[model samples]
Target: MSDSPENDSIDYGNLMHDALRLLIRNVLTDVSENGLPGDHHFFITFDTNHPDARLADWLNDRYPGEMTVVVQHWFENLDVGDDGFSITLNFGDQPEPLFIPWDSLVTFVDPSVEFGLRFEHHSDDDDDHDPDPENDEIPEAPMEENAEDDTPHEAEVVSLDAFRK
Candidate 1:
């Protein structure tokens, strides 16, 4: 067998990203089918500028870049699809529906269990800067207080730096 680097090169980064996204999808699907079990909740951060991300005009205006949503107490009509998920959440007592694509996701965290996954943001137009492991810290999103409790939750994020080259 010929040992060519090109022939043996596999896109592990993309593969891992896809697998983690599938995990998110599966979790969302389970939540949609059977509701969040135990004290489990999710802190989902996504790109608001993504083409497939749908939110109210006011929300878009308010959070033009990225937004983190807590899927805990006040959520409804959760629908999980192959490519994405849709759910209704309240904003100042006004319920609004949002559709967030899996590809648009930046991070997924379940602070109750201290489990988290952070994804690298790739832009087609961004070709100048290379991936920097040092700058890979997950960005904090504005979190709403849980209705049932006043205590704050912090996610223990898992960095994907070691797997990168």
Candidate 2:
């Protein structure tokens, strides 16, 4: 673990993080082209005020910290790209569109498949950022649920501490 030139040459962790972000983009791209399969749905949590995050002024005002949205049903205009994705979801019976960059995503989870990814963001506004609590920004009211769903929604929390040094 010397501070030699070879050891300090490049940042491997950053490369891995970038690669995972690509994976997320790829997954979203695929889901966009060929509709989501099975009981699969996504719970995406991201920083609302991130520079790359795009949404209405009211949205930013409402959710200034962390905001989570369900991509189960009633999502429209899902545009996925290399940098990020934008989609329209219902917010209290109104169509709300949100564009979020990969770097701003705090967590992506598919509870049905028990698959999830948690990201630790290094942002300029980390003064009061509290991403430790799962579903920290969940809406107070219940969102539109599946018509055939008898089971209640459940969240599977996963830790990313092991990946951090």
Candidate 3:
């Protein structure tokens, strides 16, 4: 057998994915603790099934496995502690609370500047976790939320169509 270090592989891709998640979490933590400074908003999508996820009964019912949250206008009580973040978001004219730990997060998208990151599913076992029961191919959640608060979801959903020009 040939001796090659490449044969004993390292998953640099997964490592990078984990690092990106931490970076996203840090940004969210900063924004939550201190108001997002001039023209900064985020689009965060996460798996609802990961053990650390928290959502309203209705939201959990609608999106049992995953959901995307807009960190723009109308969000309140933005608090980020050691484990995760807790914020109040409006759902169909009614405000609901949500809490999401970093681990539950499966993807993060910052449409503000044409950037996005997708994470491995719970099944990937990047860090020793059992596979989630939910189906992995379920469609992604919508990019926006229906809420009365004006938190600036706009920054998270600008026109990429401009790039086509």
Candidate 4:
């Protein structure tokens, strides 16, 4: 692809990445408002140290700066606002409060659909100041049991006569 005079300065690659992140955010926001329907579930992972992140002191003590939470049957009090959303979930055995801004979200995964998205935070210059994974203590990815896990039968081999012919 040749860069024209006007197109030379635009970085389309990064722009598309940003767009994809936005799309994921929109999906989450919708889910937050309308509630998850049927078997759909989300694994939301976010940077806990990001300026906009809010968490109970105890949760911070245990999780430090990053955590991945499952949005499932247990979550309650889901309040989504313009800047962020607040939800109450059982942390350990006690209910804990958390507030997470959209910008703080680093990754989102839907195990049912085998889909996910990752985002990076950047400064005004669009240069990423990498998150201190050590300082923030990136949490281990949570394991999700999808339909395949429960139904462990092998695929039945049915001869495809149409293709063979």
The alpha-carbon lDDT assigned to residue 69 of candidate 2 equals 84
Q: What TM-score would each prediction reach against the true structure? A: 0.75, 0.69, 0.64, 0.62
Better of 1 and 3 by TM-score: 1
* Tens-place lDDT digits, model 1, residues 1-165: 548886687766677777888889999999999999998888787777778899999888777777888899889999999879999998889999999998777679887776778665444444753445455454455632212211222222464333222
Per-residue CA lDDT of model 2 for 98-146, tens digit only, reads: 8998877767767667566656543445565565655443332222221
lDDT of 3 by residue, 1-165 (tens): 448986678766556655765677688778877887776666676666656678877788787666888777779998877677888988778999988876666456655665555454333333653234232221234533222221111111223332221
Local distance difference test, each candidate: 0.73, 0.68, 0.61, 0.60
**Best-matching candidate per TM-score:** 1
Off by over 4 Å in 4: 1-8, 11-14, 120-165
True-structure lDDT of candidate 3: 0.61
On the 0 to 100 scale, the lDDT of residue 114 in model 4 is 48
Q: Pull out the clashing pairs in model 1.
A: none
How far off is residue 159 in model 2, in Å? 5.1
Cα shift from native, residue 124, model 3 (Å)? 6.1
- Which is the leading candidate under lDDT? 1
Residue 16, model 1: lDDT of 78
Would you list the rank order by TM-score, best first? 1, 2, 3, 4
